[model samples]
Target chain A: MPTPEAWAESFTEATNGDAEIGAHGKYYSCSYMLDMQERKLIVDMHRGRVENINLDVQPLDAYEFALRAPADTWRGMGEPVPKPMYHGIWAAAFRKNLSMEGDLLVLMQNLRCFTRQIEILRETGVPV
Target chain B: MPANGRFSPVTGRYVTIDLEDPDLGGEYKVFFLENGEGRPLVCQHTAGCHNHQWRGLLEDPDITRSHRVIAYDLPRHGKSDPPNDREWWKEEYRLTADFFTKFVVALCDALELEDPIFMGSSFGGNVALQLAWRYPDRFGAVIPVEAADYSPGFFLDWWQHPHANAAQVCASGTWDLMAPQSPDQERWKTWFYYTQGSEAFRGDLSFYSVDHDLRDKLEEIDGERCPVIMMTGTYDYLTTPEMTAATAARIKGAEFIEMQDIGHFPMSENYPVFKGYLEQALQRIEERIGATVSGQR
Candidate 1:
């Protein structure tokens, strides 16, 4: 995962003085609100095609934004297998518009593992 | 014994850079800084890095005056050669950590060091931590700078994610992600490039995740008579100060220092600051050890 400094640098470089990106907490490197808005514009420009957009965000934390991402882009970034919470969140967000898949169930299992990992981090006082 | 000289024993793969210590009755690798007296501070370079990595420490006359510093190239790096058959690279790939551990032990034994202090940067730092963790009895103190704490999911994530420098890592395989310039560096690069590409090494990459959480283990070290110091740069993307601080807080007496305006490789980027910080840490270790010895006496 990129450090908050790296995320801020990248965000600043991407926006080029147009906007300022700041860290909210340990888990989220860049400002979630700003990232969401920028992602929306990129998605719109790509005609809602997720693959056409470059998220340019921290790869590990991409799951935060994956919920609002197009299905194809979400799948391309490892789908539900790697980050199940993200998949779950995506499913819940698009449940009315999309159908759930069996692989996604497996993703739920992986998400459980992710949660366990997070718990471990918390127990160890890793600040997420 | 010669001062500031080089030694290439045909039997050994590496050409040792010897920093002469007349009082010690032998010449050791350049990785060590010798006080014109006999006392020495030993250091080992991480894979694909060199003695120059610790050049900052050497440049500081105060540090050099007090401690003899020694550093050497690991097999297949620096002056070290690739195994004659090259197949040995594959066999040796899995043993990098073990080899280094043994190397440090042997060096200490050969030097008759009662309890030597160790300082490492990057991969060297990881090796140093592991060595201390496994054999806390052997070291007086340890300082790991930007050492990686790989979890089970780290590599899998790396494989899945499209990295900014994926192509380079994929091509070289060795963890010397830092760019280098020089024939010596190129030689080091080739060593990493080959070993990282080896199949045996690939499987062993999972070893990084084997002990994902070393907080408890480090805490035990803190309780020991020996001291442990964790150092990192504020801007170090690879190993941030926050991570180092967390690691430090876990250990009972582990000291954490964050060098400002520096990144992953502080020894190279902020040499003066790194040297100053290291000297301070060593002074603390010396005082602690002295107090312990005096109390026993």
Candidate 2:
């Protein structure tokens, strides 16, 4: 029952806090943060410009990206295909933290990270 | 005896097959053909198409002798009246499915049919699959011809198809022929065409849009009591034989047949060939039902 927004927030928190960034500043990429309910992706750029990277438009799953990426970078690189913006970050963040439904707090953070990645992609015009 | 008296009592006169959902209210006519001594076969017409599509098989002397044929019109098409209500029209595809499911069940209940074989083409084919999936026990056999698996993306893709012809049908309020020439006919055509253009159509399509993969379900159905057969035309622009074959492969014992040199409307395009296929299909149906061509119980 977590709203799409709350799910996004938790997604952002998980990615931002994780410490195991790959050697090339790569981090665990997912179409959606585990916290997000509806298959929305979240990614941590290792402090890279949040406003510059573009997400792919074609939806992809973790398994699919794993198959496409080179062996060494596969785990760290996000999905090969891009996905559409599942939920906007601002709406998700506000609802997750303020709403009575605290269970979705974690998911909202993840959605935040997901939306941020999308925003970055839109700015830079590069596929995520 | 009068020509009217020739009609069988079990066949019943043409009456509206009422749907449970008031939103799907409409009038339909059903003609039941009795084979010497027994109940009849129920043949449902494709939506936006007429019984004439099946004239070839119905008129075939050989096939006619073996099984009874009952052909009826869907709402707002042919002789049937549009449902008085309009809400269902807003969600045409799902409503159509619901209406069809209810209509078939009601027809069986009214006619006191034990278990009847279902024959459908195009949209009728989709209805047959749905009926089989939901009420497997009620059906003895299922024949779905050129039935496209419904999905949200499927409708979008269909709209995008180079030969959709939907827009033409919508604007003209009739399939190229203008066979229904009366004012009432034109009104019915417009209503029917517009329903196909509803957002509900898109939503219904999305609801079933699971990558066009029904192999698991079909396999389960195939293993069940009844037999399922899928037929398609070689030259069908819509619902090609390849698609039908993929659907059939999933069902363990399902039969797949592809008619040669035929198009989307095979029953109309090549009646003789269509009738031949039906003759073979009916033979298989009889074998599965354990009933003779006479249609005894």
Candidate 3:
């Protein structure tokens, strides 16, 4: 299982200079926290680029938004061969496996960037 | 149990609307979700689908905060049951322009929404234009995604004359035109295309493929009262961007936009990719509303 720092590094590495991400991501600038029971990850996107990913922030009350899903759900999502609902944020949300709270519009507006970051962790075989 | 057990992310309830009466129907209830506050935005779904298509937008606090968003399932499509008066079971349930217009007007009246911006996709997209043409002042703006005045080449007679199974054909045909990048399971899953019963899909297609033609009438929709922004996806083969652009050219001030890497099913398939384009369109509508309010003052 990848530590929160390792997952953050993988996300930064994947989307640091992607052009399409920049285009669709232009409308977003927000802070989001992802909770995986034992571990928590926070991603800060400034003007459509990954500004930082802080791992030590456990409760994530400082961020504008937070998404909480069970560790099993995150593990399934991060698996190399993820099941259908486990692959994407919307899918998980639709299935009621994930609870998204706070600035929903910010999360949706920056959905692509956030989703890609999670996928990057999966691609890097990061343990939840 | 609702068809998909999918309730609206916002208020989960069914609102009553009189379909039979010219005035709002007090008899029948149409399933709808209304969320947030501000100027109302009435959203409609594509054929054979329900209002759940707008879930992502409904759930978004930013959009909901700025616009009172409402989306409803047409009669017989979702939780709203089929009409009792009509022998709908004996014949295919064709969606007529009259039925569509009345439903919309009645729903708006019931909700006490005045001049809400109307947004729709595919079959619902075509209805948006019809709504503007038929009742010019009823709407503030009409944003029709993947729509055209007349679909010259796309054929759906296969829906009725089944050399192959109609349900399978409709599902597969829809899958092809939907977001190519969406998961295959999502593309073929019965959830997306299987609602509204078996013949309902074919019945709706008759309106989409044959009855719904607004070629000359496009010019009749006033750009001021009902500002139109025609949008189509680059990947939508059924209603090509070229077709949507041609339709937009007929209106004096109508805007046209092509959503990149998107297909016919904007909400269901490849949502994150298509949402960016939807946001842009909504922003444009907001700008027009702002301008109109400013000018009137």
True contacts kept of each: 0.00, 0.00, 0.00
DockQ, every prediction: 0.03, 0.01, 0.01
Where does the lowest 10-residue lDDT sum fall in candidate 2 chain B?
Answer: B173-182
Highest DockQ model number: 1
| TM-score, every prediction | 0.52, 0.52, 0.63
Docking class of 1: incorrect
| CA lDDT scores, all candidates in order | 0.45, 0.48, 0.71
lDDT tens string, model 3, B152-250?
Answer: 333345544444445544454454455445665555443445533445666666667777899878888876677888889766766778889999899
Q: What is the interface RMSD of candidate 3, in Å?
A: 15.0
Worst 10 residues of 3 chain B by lDDT: B288-297
**Model 2 alpha-carbon drift over 4 Å, by segment:** A1-128, B1-12, B22-39, B84-94, B148-216, B293-297
Q: Where does candidate 3 stray beyond 4 Å?
A: A1-128, B1-9, B21-27, B152-157, B160-165, B183-197, B291-297
Q: What total of clashing residue pairs does each candidate reach?
A: 11, 36, 3
Candidates sorted by lDDT, descending order?
Answer: 3, 2, 1
The TM-score obtained by chain A of candidate 2 when compared with the true chain A? 0.24
